[model samples]
Target: MDRTAAPGQSHTTPSTALAYLNPRYWDERFSEEEQYEWFKDYSHFRHLIHSHLTPNCSVLELGCGNSQMCEELHKDGATDLTCIDLSHVAVDNMQRRLLSRGLKDIKVLQADMLELPFGDECFDLVIEKGTMDVLFVDSGDPWNPKPETISKVMATLKGVHRVLKANGIFISITFGQPHFRRPIFNAPDFSWSVEWTTFGETFHYFVYVLKKGQRSSYEDIPVKRFEVPHVNLLHEELESEDFAFLINVDELNC
Candidate 1:
């Protein structure tokens, strides 16, 4: 939980790459049973999810961690709840808590998010909290170099696109520049759209409530033609990477 960046290091990296993959890391952090500081104060996340969640609808949580908010969703009448976490210990803890409380029918998966082991169009709602930042911070993950900051963000959105039913909802909270707002409405895999925003605390958090609606009928929408001015700087860096152009941005020239 080293929260501060190293001196002279403008970028922040995850303290543990694949650390959650290790059961001990999760077991230690969650065993304390105190609510994580971030979750305790953020009711906006819960409100956003509740707005999109329907009674008896299928839901999936990406990077659920040890958050108990899923139970809250269930209490609000969410049916067919499934959660994915990279940590076995975290999943085990969730399962045990559900069982102890006599809860039933929640499915949990312990797998890496970059490669979700699930069928297509399976969920009606996919929710995430601050996961994009986590992906960028995981510098040592072998999945790929610390994702081009925004590349992993787009990939996560793509994953949501694949697993969501037509008209399914994707509710995510993101922290970054205003430019990220532009893509949620135009990404080709699904028709992206906005829902809301809140300039709260230290983060300019945007609540992007995307629906897995029909992609434009035009199949010839070329990816090469999509360009932002600073994309050229990333040509050499991300050229060899599989997920290119997922995150190209100007560094604000500050």
Candidate 2:
């Protein structure tokens, strides 16, 4: 949660080399004894999720790391919940965790978000927290992504769109701002209503609610500006270590 790094300051390093793009890189990371959750826990956004979620809805969490979001959701009376990740280690570990809790109802699968294996209109809700941000990091530069990177990110969204039932919601919690992340959700063929909420003072995080089959025309979109109070969320020295390349400071620069 450290936020001292300047805009676009977080960059890929040799130690974490290609970890954003390669599944093997994540498999090795998840294989280690230590466990890490990308950002804030499920409690922070549970109300938002619960507000839109209906009883007995089929929920799919994309890139569900070692986080307890799925377990907590299952405990909160959500049945038919499925969690997926590209790393087998992540999937296996989550499965064991659920088994230990005697929660065999929740399904954990090793699958790629880019090419989802589900049938069309299979899920009532699809949630992603920081998964799309990781994909943006792998796309070279966040401000200006390469063609293939944009395609990959769009393809992932298309997959999500295809699998979602009519009027289904796709909630994304990300460090990316409106300007950087809005375009991806505004594709011509896709029909989605994008609404965002920003949290935190100096270092902000966004929760984007995308409602499928509810398209908001480009002209109707409004410009948003965020103001920082010049306060530090983390110690200056721990900024680089804490952020780990996923935090985007572009808003701070602007």
Instruction: Go through the candidates in order and give each one's C-alpha lDDT.
Output: 0.57, 0.72
Quote the RMSD, in angstroms, for model 2.
6.3
- Candidate 2 residues lying further than 4 Å off, grouped into runs, are 2-14, 218-254
Q: Which residue pairs show collisions in model 2?
A: 7-249
Q: Write the per-residue lDDT of candidate 2 for residues 25-71, one digit (tens) a residue.
A: 66765665334555566666677677877888999999997777887
Each candidate's number of clashing pairs is 1, 1
**1-254: candidate 1 lDDT, tens digit per residue:** 11222233222111333342345655566554433322232454566566677777999888776666677778877868998887676778778878878777888779767777778998888877655545543333222234563476667677788888888988766543334444434555556454556535533456667666644545224323333344333333322221112233222111
Steric clash pairs (candidate 1):
14-137
- As a TM-score, model 2 comes out at 0.81
